[model samples]
Target: MSIAGVLILPQVIQRGDPGEVVHFFGIPIVLASYTSSVIPMIVVVWVQGHVERWLKRTLAASIENFTTPFLILLILPSATLMTIGPVTMAFSAGISGGVEWIFEASPWVAGAVMGGLWQVFVMFGLHWGLIPIMINDVATLGYSVMKAPVVASVIAQGAAALAVFFRLRRDHKIKQAALPSGIASLLAGITEPAVYGVNLPLKRPFIIACLSGAVGGAVTASGGSAADNLANPSLLSISAYLNHGNFVVFCLGVLISFLLAFFGTLFFGIPRSAREEEQPQELSEDLDSGIPAQPVPADKKVVDADAQVVPAGVVVPVAVDEGNTTDLVAAASGHAVPLSEIEDPVFSSGAMGQGLGIRPATGADGSSDAESPTGAHPGRIVAPISGKLTAAMNSGHAYGVRADTGVEVLVHVGIDTVQLDGREFTPHVTKGDTVTAGQVLVDVDLPTVTEAGYDPTVITIITNSDHFSTIEPRTGIDLAAGDLTVVVER
Candidate 1:
C-alpha cells in the first residue's frame, strides 16, 4: 500500500474521474476511490484475520479453503471500503485538522509547551494520548508536526544521563549504570531508564533537560519540521524526514537539545554530594581485609577501666586506654545548643546517642561561616579527634570515628538529610581513612540542604557513651572547628 501510494496511485487518480465504473467479465464493479488511502487496506487485513479463523472452524477442510479465499478477496475488501475505511479516514482527518489548527495559531508556543511537558506526560504515562493523534496525522496528512518537538524531549533526557556519566567519572557504581542507559537513549531513543533511574533522582538535571528540550522544540516548530512516518525519534529513524524540506532544521534542533542538556547538567545540575555518594559498594564489602587478625602482646595492650574484654574471638581489635578524659571538638564553626533543643526527635531525645546540635554561624557576607569561598554551603566538616574512621556514609551526611582513647563519636550533619541522598555533601575521606583533629572530613552546601527542606544543624554525638564513665556535652557556647564541645572520661 505504501509503495502504491508513493509510486503508482497518484497517476491512477489523475487518469480517472470520481464515481467512475469499470467492468469485469460483463459484470459491473463500482470502483469506490481507494488510491493513496491508509485505512482501507488496514481494515481489510484486520477483518481478514477474524474472518479466516471463523471460516476454518465452521467449514469442512476442502470447502473451507476455497470459500475462505473467495470471501476474503471479494467480501472483505468491499466491506472495508464501504464502512471501516471511510469512517476511520474521516476520524483521522478531524484529528489532523485540529492539531494543524493549534500549530498554525502559535507554532513556537505550541512547540515549547509540548516539548517541556512531554517528559512530564511520559512520567505520568499520559503521553499515550498523543501517540494515536501523531499516528493519525501521519496517516491523513502524510506527516506529523506534533512528534517533531517530542523528539527533543527524548533526546534531552539521554543528554542529561550522559552529562552525569561524564561528571561522576570517579563513581564506578554510578558510571556502570549511567553509561549504558545514556547510550541506549542516544542511539535507540529509549529514555525512561535515564529519566527515572538517573536524572529525576538528582532533581536539577531533570529540570535542565526539560528546559533544553523546550528550546529545541521551539526551534523545530519555528522551522516547520514534521515527521513523515509514525516512528520514534532516533538516529535510525532520521530517514522518516528525508523527503521533508525541514530535515536539516530537525537535525539542528536535535543537536541543540542534546548539547544544551548535556552541558547544562554537567555544569550546574548535579551536586558534589550526589557525586560523592556514587562510591562502589566494594569498599565496604571487604570487611575482613580491614580487620586485625592477631592480638597485640599483653605488654602493648593497655586496657581502660571502662573497656570490657570480650574473648579474643571477635574479628576486629578494640582500642583501649587508661582512665583519662578525651576532649571531642566541634566539627563545624557554630554556636552549640543542647540536643534537647533540636527540632527532630531522633536528636532531641538522644536516640542517635548523646550529642549537642550546632546552629552554623553566619558570616558578614550573609553566608554561613561553614560555606566555602566558592559560595557552596556547609563549608566543611572537620575531624573532632585524631581517630580511625570506622564507618562513613557515602552520602557524606554522617561519619563514625573511634579515637585511640576508646571514644567513638558520630558527626551527623542534619535532621532527615539522609533522604536527600547526599545532594549537598562532599566527602574528603572514605571509611577506614585515618583522620587527625581539624582535618577536613567533608564539605557541605548548607544552603542547598536547607532549600531542600532539611534542617542544617550539625550534631556531634558520643556514639559509644557506654564505653566511657561520663560523656559531658557543652552547649550555648560559640565554637570553631577543633574547639572542645564534648568531654568523654574513660
Candidate 2:
C-alpha cells in the first residue's frame, strides 16, 4: 500500500499532488509510507507480539483461538496506522539524521567510535537501529559511506584471529579453529566464527581488533572511500567499491586494519598459559577414548619410557602406596560418568585437565536427599583432597583446591548453574581456607538445579594433569562422598 504500485488497499487511492491518501469514513488519516523502513516494522511486530500474548492470557480457552484472531485482525492494524507508524517513522528519521550530522561534522571521531564499538553494538543488538539508515542511503543516494567503517571492523576481527593462531603454542585445537575463522572473515563477511570462537574468548585480542578497526575506519572515511553498492563487506566484495569509490584507499584501509590488529595481538594479546607447552595430547585422550592402554599383569613390570609426563600406573595389589601418588576422593555420591560425556568443551576436551562427571541422584520428592531434614546432606560436596581452598566463587557453584603435592582440583557443581545466582547452592567454605578431605565445600540442591533447566552433575577436574605422571579415573559406577575415585601419580 505504501509503495507506488504494490497491493491496492480499499479506500486508499492516489489523489492529487502529495501522493496516496486513505479516505476512510471521513476520518483524518496519517498517510505514513512503510516503504523499506525498518524501525516502524520492528515496533509494529513487537507490539503485535505483546498484544497476542495478552489476548492469549486474557481470553477464555473456549474462544481463545477464534476470538483472539478476530480481535487482533479487527483492532491492531487500524490502531497501528493511527499510532505506531507515524511516531516510529519520525523517531527513526530524527535519530538517523542526527547521527549523519554528527558524522559529517566530526569524521575522525565518528569513524573511531563507530569502528571500535561496532562489535559491541552487534553484541547488544544496537546495530539494528542503523540498518534502515544504511538501506535508505543505498535506495535514495545509490551508495552508502556509513558502511566503509564497518568493513574495516570485519577485517580487524579476522586479523585478530590470525594473530591468535600465530601466537598460540600449546593448544592445537584453538589454532585449528582460529585459522579457519580468520580466513572466513577475510574472504567472506562472516564475523560470528571469529568473534565468538577466537577474539571474544581471548578478551585482549577483541580490544586490540576494535582499536585497529577504529584506526582503519578513520583512514577509510577521511581518505574518501565509499561503497557504490550495498554489498557484504569482505575482500570478495571489494569489486563493488571499484566502480565509484576510491578503491586504492579502500585497500589501504583494510590493509592498515589487518596489520595493526595482527601485530597488536601478537605483541600483547596472548595469555601466558596459551603459549606454554604441555604434555602430549594422546595421553589425555586415552583416558576417555574407551580404549585403555594395555594394563600390565600384577606381577609384570609396566614400562612407560615413552610416556610424556610420567609412567602409566595400573599395577596391582599394594598400589605402590607411596611417594608422589595422590588419591582424590569423590565430592558427593552419584552415578559417575566419563568426562567425554560432558557438554562443556573446556572440561570434555581435557583442556582444563582430566575431569570426572557425576550426575546427582534424586530422592522421592524430585529434590536430592541432600536437602532432607536429617542434617546429613549426602548430596553435599566435600573437598576431594586435603588442600588449600584456592578458588571459591561467591555464587557457590565451583571451588578449587590446591594440594601440597602440587595437584590442583576444581570441583564444579552443575553446568551453567551460575545463572541461578546461587539459588540452589550453599557455600560452606571461602577462598584461601585450608580444608581437609571430606570437609563440606558447597551443599547442592539437585532438584532446584534440574528445575532451573541445568544439568546437576558434579564435576571434579585435575587442573594440572599433564604435570603428573598418570591420571586414572574410575567412572561408570556409583560414587559416595569421600570415596577414593581418582589416582594421580607424579
Candidate 3:
C-alpha cells in the first residue's frame, strides 16, 4: 500500500480519479483514494489477529484452510473498506486538524513546550498518549511536524549522558555503563537508560538537556520541517525527513541540540564537590597490595582493629578475626522495617534471601526533601562487611559485596527501582574494588524514589546464607550507617 501510494498511485490519479468504482466479478468495488495510509492498515491488521483466532476455533481442519483464506482475503478486506477504514481515516483527520491548529497558532511556543516536556511525559508514562497523534498526522497530512522536535529531545539526552561519561573518565565502572547507554539514545532514539541512569541522578545535565532540546525544536519548527513517517526520531531515522524539503534544517537542529547539551553539561552540570570526591588517587607500585591491605587468614592470627581502618567514615565495632563472626553494617540510617512489610513480592517473600528492609528517614518534617538542588534524602550505602566489591549494577540501585571470609551480601536500594534505570542513585565504588568497613558504596536520592511511586526501603540480604552457620538481624531499631544490622557466622 505504501509503495503504491508513493510510486504508482500518483500516475494513476493523474489519469483519472483514484476513488472511482469498478466492477469485478459483477460486484462493485469502491477503490480507496487513501489506500497508502497507515491508520487504516494498522486497524485492519489489529482486527485480523482476533479474527484469525475465532476462525480457527469454529472451522474444521479439512475445510478451515480454504475458508480461512477466502475470509481473510475477500471478506476481511471488504469489511475493512466498509467499516474500519472510513472510521480510522476520519479519526486521523480530526487529530491532524487539532495538531495543525496548535502548531499554526504559535509554532515556536508549541515546539518549546513539547520538546521540554517530552522526557517528563516519558518519566510518568504519559508520552504514550502522543503516539496516536503522531501516527494520525502522517496518515492524514502525509507528514508530521510533531516528531521533528522530539528528535531534538532524544539527541539532547544522549549528549548529556556522553558529557557525564567524559566528566567521570577516571571511573571505569561509570564509563562502562554511561557510554553504551549514551550511544543507544543517540543512535536508536531510546532515552530511558540515559535519562534515568546518567542524567537524572546528576540533575543539572537533565535540565540543560531539556533547554537545549527546546532550542533545537524551535529552530526546526521555524524552518517548517516535518517527518514523512511515524518512525522514531533518531539519527538512523533521518531518512523520514527526506520526503520534505526541510531535511537539512532537521539535521542542523539535531546537531545543534547535541552540541549544546554536550558542552552545557561538560562545563556546568557536574558539581565541584563530586569532582573533588571522584578525583583519581595515587596508586602504589604494587597494585596487588590492594586498598586496606589484605587481611592475614584467620588461621594465621587475629588482626588488630587499629591496623584495619575502615574507609569513607564507616566504623567497624569489632577487630578482624577471619574465623570469627563478621558484622554487616546498616548502609543507611533509617527506621528498621521487616521484610514482610515491603511492597514488592520478591523482597517481601524473602525469596531473594533472608534480609531486613529499612524505610529511610526523610527531612525533619517527615516530608520528602527532593526539592533541594542536590536531591532529597542525602545518604550513602556504606560497606556492610570489609570485603571486595564483587558485583555492582550500573543503575546504582544494587550492589554485591563478598567478604574475605566468604560472606556475600546483596544491598538493594528501593523495591522495583530498576524500573527507574538509575535516576536517583550514584555509585561511589565500582565492581572488583576492595572496600573496607564504612566505605561509601553508593549515594541515593530517597525523595526521588518516593516521588516515582516506589518504596524507598533498602533491603540487605546475605546471598550466601548456606555458608554461614547463623544470620542474625537487628530489627525494630533506628540504625545509622555502619551500625550492626546483621551478623554472619562462618
Return the candidate ranking by lDDT, descending: 2, 3, 1
For model 2, state the Cα shift of residue 214 in Å. Answer: 0.4
Colliding residue pairs in candidate 1? 370-379, 377-444, 377-445, 377-446, 378-446
Candidate 1 lDDT (Cα, whole model)?
0.77
Off by over 4 Å in 1: 1-85, 169-172, 277-490
Give TM per candidate.
0.44, 0.56, 0.48
Clashes of each: 5, 1, 1
User: What's the true lDDT of residue 300 in model 3?
Assistant: 88
Best by lDDT: 2
On TM-score, the stronger of 1 and 2 is: 2
Candidate 3, residue 203: the lDDT equals 91
lDDT (10s digit) by residue, model 3, range 1-490: 3322332355434432456665546776555555445666667778877887899899999999889767776566556655565577677787788788877787777777777788988999888878777876776578888887898899999999998888864445655677888999989999989998888877998999999999888777766778888777888998888876467877888899999999999899887665544547888998767657667886788758797666864545656565778788777777767778888898778777777887777553443322222232335667788888999999998889988878888988887889988887878889999998778888877776787788878889888777777887877877777767887777
Candidate 2 C-alpha error for residue 427, in Å? 33
Instruction: Give the worst 10-residue stretch by lDDT in candidate 2.
Output: 1-10
- CA RMSD of all predictions: 23.4, 14.4, 20.5
